[model samples]
Target: MATDPVCKMNVEPAKAAAKVDYNGQLYYFCSESCHKAFTEAPQKYAGAAPPPHSSHQHGHR
Candidate 1:
């Protein structure tokens, strides 16, 4: 699973229908709105480092 950068929601990497590539990193989103928001200014949202243990245990940004 991966965290949706726009809303900090849990997104299954294999199931996400919305995703964007920013600076060579992949960001998954829960909805089109979230995806568009990130698309507008990817650098602003793309730089966000997930919370501690986010790669496993999820948390807010």
Candidate 2:
């Protein structure tokens, strides 16, 4: 499963209706809206490295 950059929801790549590839990596989105969100401000989510996350410790992007 992949994560929605906008809502941070777990999303299955096969179930995703939209996606974007950046920096040679693929990002799966739950919907077009999330895809657009990630596409528009990729820098916000991409420029920095995200820390590891857990259910009790959600990581920052």
Would you list the clashing residue pairs of candidate 2? none
lDDT, candidate 2, 1-61, per-residue tens: 9877677789999999798888776878888987887888997875544534433454545
Assess the local accuracy of residue 40 in candidate 2 as a C-alpha lDDT between 0 and 100.
87
For residues 6-43, write the lDDT of model 1, one tens digit per residue: 88899998888698777667889888998999999887
TM-score of every model versus the real structure = 0.73, 0.69
Measured with C-alpha atoms, the lDDT of residue 34 in candidate 1 is 89
lDDT of each: 0.81, 0.77
Per-residue lDDT for 16 in model 2?
A: 93
CA displacement after TM-score superposition, residue 45 of candidate 2 (Å):
1.9
